[model samples]
Target chain A: MLKIKVKLVDGKISKKEMVLNKKEVTVQDILDILEINRETVLIRKKNELITEEEILDNGDEIEILRVISGG
Target chain B: MDKSPKCSRCGKKAIIDIRYREEKLCRRCFLKFFEKRVHRNIEKNKMIKPGDRVAVALSGGKDSTLTLYILKEMLNKVKCELFAVTVDEGIKGYRDKAIEFAKRNTKELDLTHIIVSFKEIFGYTLNEIVEKNKVLRGARGPCTFCGVFRRRALNILSRELKASKVATGHNLDDESQTYLMNFFRGDIESSLKMNCDESISELFVKRIKPLSTTPEREIAAYALVKGIPFHMDECPYAQEGMRNVVRVHMNKIESTFAGSRENFYYFMNEIIKHLKTKEKMKFKLSSCILCGEPSSKEICKVCELLKIIRG
Candidate 1:
């Protein structure tokens, strides 16, 4: 199980915890599993930017910020 | 992510992994790189000249805010003046928050900020125009009206403020999406004329895009990293536009292929350059007969659209 927090554009935290049966999962892999477009969100761990392929250990908390700017 | 936490330059804790360069950078180094790239772009493109007044079309979004912030930072080095203008299309609950952010940023920077509304310019807010457009026999999307009106409003306000150049926060993503949108629409003329590499008129203020090479993701990251307060909510009518469709697909392609945005930019630039030389397409600029606005033809599209909306 990996802890994921979804942050909306308005800066609000939307809880979205994910539980997978696999023992090892990368950031990109989980995002892919969740069907989140990699380009549409920024992934961060411990308040620092992390790329998509970073491996996630069980109980590791991450924040995925939604990025949408259309005019 | 290879779990590298050290900045490529300083060995500090990394804040971003720039996939294009295949390098990870700390906050300080990332910001330095971002500013340097923007400054280099401005210098290389000759986008700004000494004694020139630049009016930024600030929407308070990440892209425009970063544009204004970077340009303002370059004031001492570039020998230019800067102000900001915000065009309010009067979309309820959408534009109001953005304008507030625009006002806040300008206030903080101590720069002059001007805002013009669609109601004042066209006698109709965007909401009203959309409502009226709905009952009409045949009408374009709200984006069509908003786009035309916003461009006109930006031009008028920038000119009135005695701006020598108008700067918008259109980044690489927006530019590529626009090109793809036109290409998909089968609008070859628009694609060819996208850059306006030559044949610019002296009548209207020249438009500049300093952030053309920077990706939208970088802009958003810069805003957050710098603690720059910005309005992040998208416009309500954005999802209804075809550009949104193109944007989604382009992003998907970008994800699958890192640095594809810049690649598209380089590829497209070469094509546009070759097309301009081979076709000898000199788009002569003319003033609109009714409104005296700069147009490619006798009457501007804004005026033509206004006629339909006012009827």
Candidate 2:
């Protein structure tokens, strides 16, 4: 089983150990696990933005973010 | 090996089960699950008109370039006339390359182009102004000068070209960023103005954004696929800036929220529809003190910029 650790912009960690061995997972799947909307969040795996369709691999550290909006 | 086109919405592998036409938005984006449902929403709102003379404000970026391409296609069906205008801010390194791209694309599109130079019109390029101002009042932000100057310059050129409507390259991401910025700044009036459709104002030409519903990535992809000339280089002055921070933050929100950008427009539209602004139009005009054109102040922003150059 592939275990993935997740990090939030506020430095919060996901409580669950994500097992990604069963099937292909995506950035959206991780967001689903984290219980956040796509619009309110951005994901970076290894400091690069991962679009929703980007398949996830084992041992990837995902950073989720809430973007700031305004002038 | 799979033999399907990438999803247009998400750029993922196309699953045959989804019945998508082209590109991979998955089942999610294909169903219009986006937060900023700009594509359909604009059609429902009836913002675009047939036979309109549209002068696009080109910045040689992905958004504006793709906007011109799409508008060119859309207008063909509607018999609309199209033109291009680029405001040269004279930013060394940043704008020089973009202007070249803008001019190239204008020729490719076979459209009449107008290039307004800050150096010629304002007598001081951005570099000169920033340098001069820094010696006196210290270093003001690049955006502080660029935004005011470019907007005024575009408006004047749009009028000079006798265009009824000035089209902008503002897309969903830009609009969403602006909406949130206005919300944070407590600027309800400006927010309301953004959501409002093109209306004739004495002070300025009517402004519109035909690509308001399109996503930033889609525009970039369109530009790339169509091979439309564009400047991808990051502006030298744009590093670690406040708007850059806002852009990064907006992208983050956009990734998490399926329709955050769409939601922004809806939110603004709702406010405009129901709770209209009680605040007076901040720049209501008497007349342009110099050119006798309509202006919010005695002298318009365009005239003020010209005075700085003429002095």
- Candidate number of the best TM-score: 1
Instruction: Give the lowest summed-lDDT range of ten residues in model 2 chain B.
Output: B14-23
* Model 1 lDDT, full chain set: 0.82
Please write out the lDDT profile of model 1 over residues B1-311, one tens digit for every residue. Answer: 45545788998767777877888788899999998888888888888889999999999888888889888988978788999999989899989999999999999999999888999988999999888887775358999999888988998888888898899999888889888888778876777756664546656677889999888888888888888999987788888899888888888887778888789888988887777776466566788999888888789889988887877
Model 2: which docking level applies?
incorrect
Error of 1 at B287 (Å): 1.9
Local error of candidate 1 at B262, Å? 1.4
How large is the C-alpha RMSD of every model relative to the true structure? 2.5, 7.8
lDDT of 2 at B272: 65
Q: Rate the local accuracy (lDDT) of all candidates.
A: 0.82, 0.65
- Across all models, the iRMS values in order are 3.4, 9.3
| Candidate 1 error regions (>4 Å) | A1-13, A69-71, B1-6, B9-11, B197-199
Q: Indicate the TM-score of model 1.
A: 0.92
User: On a 0 to 100 scale, what is the lDDT of residue B93 in model 1?
Assistant: 90
